[model samples]
Target: MKIELIYPRWKKLEGQTTFHLPPHGPVVMAAALPPGVELDFLDENVDPRDALAACEGCDLVCISMMLTSQVKRGWALADQLRARGLRVLFGGIASMLHAEETLAHADALFLGEVEGRLGAVLEDLAHGRLQKVYNFMQAHPPIELVGPARRSILRDELYHHKGVRMVDLFHASRGCRFKCYPCAVAYLGGRSFRPRPMARVAEELAAIPNGRLFVVDNSLAQDKEWEKELFRTMIPFKKTWCSHTIEDDDEVLALAAQAGAWYVYQAVFDTSDFIRQRVKRYHDHGIAVEGTVLLGLDDQTEDSIRRLIDFLLEIDLDLAEFTVLTPFPHTKCRDDLRKQKRILSDDWDRYTAGEVVFQPKHMSPARLQELYHLAWETFYRDEPQSMKMMKLLQRAVARERALGTYRGRRRDLVRQSFGRELTDEERGV
Candidate 1:
């Protein structure tokens, strides 16, 4: 059987950074497929050829739709694939929550983890007895069996920035302990935390073949004992990594730093004293902290919004990412806004965190949107204060790249002086 595992383009608003990381969901699905299937994996964001041409002669077209920004594109691609008499299946977080809408485009919809469900789907395909919907959210496959993501199919060069391939997305766990109103993790992965076995996780990390990684777990600090053990086990691998954090204990923070922790996305919900202390603790442990601030919350006003940005600088956070409260489908925030009839737009394009699509309790939607843009503009403006913080890192990165190039050239020149033919590695090509 020939299958085209596709990742549709996610729309990004102007001024927003288009993150072109390895789409872990689709590649992981490709990894989970049963044997005897030929997979042509195309992340359309980077591999842009006509979608129809890309999937030509493929028996099944499977698209993983996780972001609202890309749901529309996934649907269009699904429609086209179905028009060509190809079987189209839609799955992932976005499709899981909006299954009814997704069914309109796909011949089948796969809800929940692909671990146990994919085999049955493939069997159905082989026998020509595929069902319209496959439900496997209830079946929790043990973490060890989740399988490694198939990365050989990736075009790695297309995902680099400033000579760094950024980070490889790897999941050591599923779900989160906290059910934040605006987040969809709980909805998709459930409230209870499920972690991959420590040995299994270490093996996956070793297989990645990259020093920089982004562990896509909800919060690595949640289970203290397991995290300590995981960190201790990771010492031999010596890979630098980062993950998101909740308020963590001193011991866990210490363990994380020892285990190659580089930075963490610590949410700054407010300018509270504890938030300041938390940032300091991370810095004290030699782990940089990135502030993930959610703007336009019910408590935020224009004054408060500006004050938050000022507070970020005052705390000397390594970096910051600002986002408006996006009401994704099936999340608590979306449900509440729907009850109040405050959702202003059904358009998925506006769902990017930069745009305001729902009514807020304290301010006009327009005001909230304005403040969102202002938060970014003010943080990244050409002022010495802002530039000093951000540009310092840019300059440091530039220096590292130049130094690496110099060392490579120096080595090549020495080899040439020996009158030896250049090996592929020595050519510095």
Candidate 2:
């Protein structure tokens, strides 16, 4: 059976530049399909028309999309594919959260992780007995079952403009242990960390085309022992990699750097004076810590936003990603925001973490939007002569050079300033 898997793109907005790549979920799923089922994967975020065309010869189509923005486009594509007489299967965090709604359009909805249920779904399809829903909760299908995903699947031409020759993505673990108010990880993978064996993970990392690695684990240092094992195994490669980590362990940070982790994405939830000291420590370790701050938490105020921004500037971190507090489906923040009536918009497309979905307790939505832009402008606006920026520029240049293509792409709604603060359109209450 020919199966086509798709990842959709959101509508474009002015001044926003989106980094489009095939998300890890569908690619991992494709890796898991039982033998004899021909597979084609499409990341519509790169080229929508080509992705849609790739679906032409497939008997079955599977789609995975983000919950907030991509659902509308995902549903539209599924409906179109269904109309053309192809069996449509849907899954992803979005589908898992809104399974019944997604089922209205899809012939089957594969909820949760796709590894365990994928084979059964395929088997059922072969016998013309496909089920309406397949859930693979807490099941870790063997890594070897899905043939190693070739790095060639991502176009070499995409990274050319930045001068980076190659990039490869690896998944070392799944789920998050912390119950961050705005996170969707706990909802999808539960509040526990399930790491693949260190040897298995290292082997997969070794298999990728380029030596450059991006470990897609939510938090890499949740388990110190596993992390130590991983670092030990990776030390031999001496290849530079990037991953997210919490701010607790100095040993783990040092080991990660020794293991070729050039970039560390660290979250500074509440920027206390103590946390500021930790941030400085991370920078002192020769690791380019991209310090991130959440702006719309319950107690966020303008003074707090400015203080956080000032702290980030003071720390002289390499890069930063500033995001509003989003209440995604199945997250504690979502429930809390619902209860507090803080959600400003229910449009899933606006929930990209870039937009203000919930009203702040201490500030208006407009002020929040202003602060969001201010954070980006403050960090990226000033061109610095520091080695960190130089290194980031080098990496960015290398990445662009490796991809070999450049186009003037505009930013999306989330990246733009709101002319007027928008309110929930669905509410007449």
Candidate 3:
């Protein structure tokens, strides 16, 4: 059987540098498909026309929706495909979060992790006994069954920017132990932290052909020992990476630095000394810090929001991403806002973190929206995100050079220029 795996595109955050990092969910799902099935993976972000053409000879069309913003488009794609007599399957984080609504648009909806389970779903498809839903949300397979992602399905050339390859996405674990208010991960992947065995993680890492990666675990801080071991396991690979928060302990941060941690996205909710120290700790370990600051929280007054923006500048974060709080389905934030009848919109498209979909306790929704843009403008005004990103790239390149994995042509050009004496014009004389 043949399947066309489609990762529907969504609107990126406004004012952010637009780049597509090869997605992890689709490639991982590709690995879980039973052998002998021809797979064509299409990321619609690159080209929607090519994804549309894949429907020609495919036996099934599978849509993977990772973000809430992507669900509307995913539903539309499924509706279009199913109209032409092709079967459609929905899976990934967004699918689980919006299962009831998604089910209406799909022939079969596969919920939860696909490892050691998707084969049966395929068997059902082969026998004309496909069920309406394959719900595996609570039945996470043993972590050992997780294998290397089928990254070969991706068109490597299409995932680059300015001739530099984008980082390939990888994961060493699933689920988050903490149930943060605005996050749906706990409901989607459970509150228990589920880590893949070290051996399996090592296997996948070794098999990945990219020299850089985005370690997409929900949060590496869940288990200290596992987090440290994961870094140790990764040290020999000499792969530079960035990820969400890591354990704040000194030893864990040191191990991560040794393991080629390029930077990390850490939450900077307040201007407290503890938060300041946490950013400093990561920096002291030679890891750059990217602040993921969310505005419009119940505790944040307009004055406090302005204070938080100034605090970000004071902390000297390498970069900062500003997003308004969004109430995604199944998250605690959604429940509370729904109860208060303050949710202004149920349109999934506006659920993109960049937009204000609910009333803020301390300010009007319009005021909250204004502050959101203000946060971005204020934080990026001095250094600008692109320049900051270039600095991070320089760090990654230096790290790669130290590890003997540097392969960029620009590095060779820089070395040659330094070897020769510069003329007057070149020296800006």
Query: Among these predicted structures, which one has the highest TM-score?
Result: 3
Best-to-worst ranking by TM-score: 3, 1, 2
Off by over 4 Å in 3: 409-429
Clashes of 2: 29
Per-residue lDDT of model 2, residues 1-429, tens digit only: 898878777764333433444366676777667778877666665543566677887989988876567887888898988887888899877888767678898999887776656788888988999998786655645544434554544544443222333346677777778777767777678777777776677677667655556777888868898887788788776566777873357887777767767677888766687767776776666666787778888777789888888878877777777778888787888898899887778887776777777778898888898899888777766753243446764654454354442222222222221112224441222
Q: What TM-score fits each model?
A: 0.89, 0.85, 0.94
List runs of model 1 lying over 4 Å from the truth.
382-429
lDDT string for model 1 (1-429, tens) is 898888888766677545577878887787788878888877777675677898889888898877888888899888878888889989888888778889999888998888756878888887999888988775667667876787876766556533345568888888788888788888789888898888778778778876567878888866888888878877676666778883467887787877767778999988899999999999888778878989877788888888998898889887778888988987889988888898889898778887888888889988888888787777766454344444534433443364342111233234331223446564466
**TM-score, prediction 3:** 0.94
lDDT of 3: 0.90
Q: Which runs of model 2 end up more than 4 angstroms from their true locations?
A: 11-17, 139-147, 150-152, 159-166, 384-390, 393-429
lDDT of each: 0.77, 0.70, 0.90
Candidate 3, residue 30: the lDDT equals 93
All models, RMSD in angstroms: 6.5, 8.2, 5.2
Which 10 consecutive residues of model 1 have the lowest summed lDDT? Answer: 405-414
Which is better, 1 or 2, measured by TM-score?
A: 1
Model 2 TM-score, all chains together: 0.85
